[model samples]
Target: MNNFKFSENIESYLVSAKDIFISKIASGIKTRDELFTSLYNTLLLPGYFGFNWDALFDCLRDFHWIDEYLVIIVHEDLPTLSEEELRIYLHLLADACLDWKIDEEHKLEIVFPESVRCKVEHLLSAD
Candidate 1:
């Protein structure tokens, strides 16, 4: 999501899709896997937050573990998004982990693998 300067059409779609995922996470209407499904569905767009959430979840599920996250960040909007917005996006992901009762320490071990995790970390850290 770092290169969010996408075509207006792609950005527009993600703008709406972010809202959908945000609302679902907020209202307890969606689970971690459901959120990933919605995200994967929208990933056809270039500059979209394309992730291996499905593959990761499949691996975790075999161990009876689950993971959840949101690919959007306030930072994705660049100068348009405030630090507050970035925190909000991150906060939502944290809340989902809490809601699902994921143990923090284990989650650290389970989320994204090193190479992919570093990229995602850089994306989220973008100001």
Candidate 2:
């Protein structure tokens, strides 16, 4: 499992030779519903998706439908959710990363732009 943050040179990170599945969450996601919808569409989640945090974690940890060994989720911008929801989202990401590490079948990487890196780190570190 690799670190979540990409180096300052994202171009180099994007130059991987291995097969990878990349999903981009476009900006302007202000609500949990929008975030779920974007993830559902971008990741091509199964119809059984419940559109909730648990469902997201389940689907993210079980990317059996995706053939690529490396899965990269790039967030164009952070969502405008309540503190609790944001904390849950970040924990979900960290949990999924840990789950993938144990599974050893796929690698999950979450990338945030440099502009919001500090904010993201702060949120993740908050108790």
Candidate 3:
């Protein structure tokens, strides 16, 4: 949902990650594994935000598809959410991702609002 107007190249880059994600799911991969694998792989890569956000924006941005992964990170980083809340957040994120839509009604749950939600939701649902 980043309103910052990322370049089309950025969107295309994100789409690449999204393609991998869909393939993973279609192949019966676990959600956590898919997300973390993508994020961790991207984070370990070279550039800003630990790696260029545009180049891996699907896994990095504030979309429903990635909130569970961020929620897991939040437990490690925020030190506030209880084990149950973290679990709940993960479920919420999963539900949101499964039913994503570009319309105004689908408000993505942002545990931490670093980027836009709706725009990312749009990209996620576009597939």
Candidate 4:
């Protein structure tokens, strides 16, 4: 995805996302909580990360500590998130990513299963 530039304003966020996926979080995760913990530990956010959806959003947007963009790689064995749950999680991530653009300092990306990649991408793109 090196040459995959986003819209006029998105910039090169995907490059950092791809690097993070290859180096840090390219594992087989099963649950949303697992994903959250893995990302939290990878990014080394705060010791008191809430490890919940709301907390995740807060930590992602509150990246005053780590100024790098955040890219989440969701490999196989991901938990069976319901449609509603999936939408909520993706929405939060998408929101965090967009908010990062305010300072052009951080961003978020998610690579889901091929089965749901299109669906998830559609959801994020729709935002």
Best by lDDT: 2
Q: 39-100, model 3: which lDDT tens digit per residue? A: 45433423333332233334333433332222221111111334444344344444544444
Candidate 4 per-residue lDDT, tens place, 2-81, comes to 21122332222234543253214434555677777777876677988888888888986676666445445333323456
Candidate number of the best TM-score: 2
Q: Give residue 6's lDDT in candidate 1 (0 to 100).
A: 26
When 3 and 4 are scored with lDDT, the better candidate is 4
- Model 1 TM-score, all chains together: 0.24
List candidate 4 segments past 4 Å from native. 1-23, 67-79, 102-104, 111-115, 122-127
Query: Lowest lDDT 10-mer window, candidate 3?
Result: 70-79
Listed in order, each prediction's TM-score against the native is 0.24, 0.87, 0.22, 0.60
Ranking by lDDT: 2, 4, 3, 1
For model 3, the stretches where C-alpha displacement exceeds 4 angstroms are: 1-79, 102-127
Each model's lDDT: 0.33, 0.82, 0.34, 0.57
lDDT of 1 by residue, 23-111 (tens): 11111213444444443443222233334443533332232222223333222222222445434433444443444334432221112
> Lowest-scoring 10 consecutive residues by lDDT in candidate 1?
18-27
User: What lDDT does candidate 3 reach at residue 15?
Assistant: 37
lDDT of 2 by residue, 1-127 (tens): 2347744544544554568888878878989999999999989999999999999999998898888888888887678888899889988997788776645778898887777777777888877
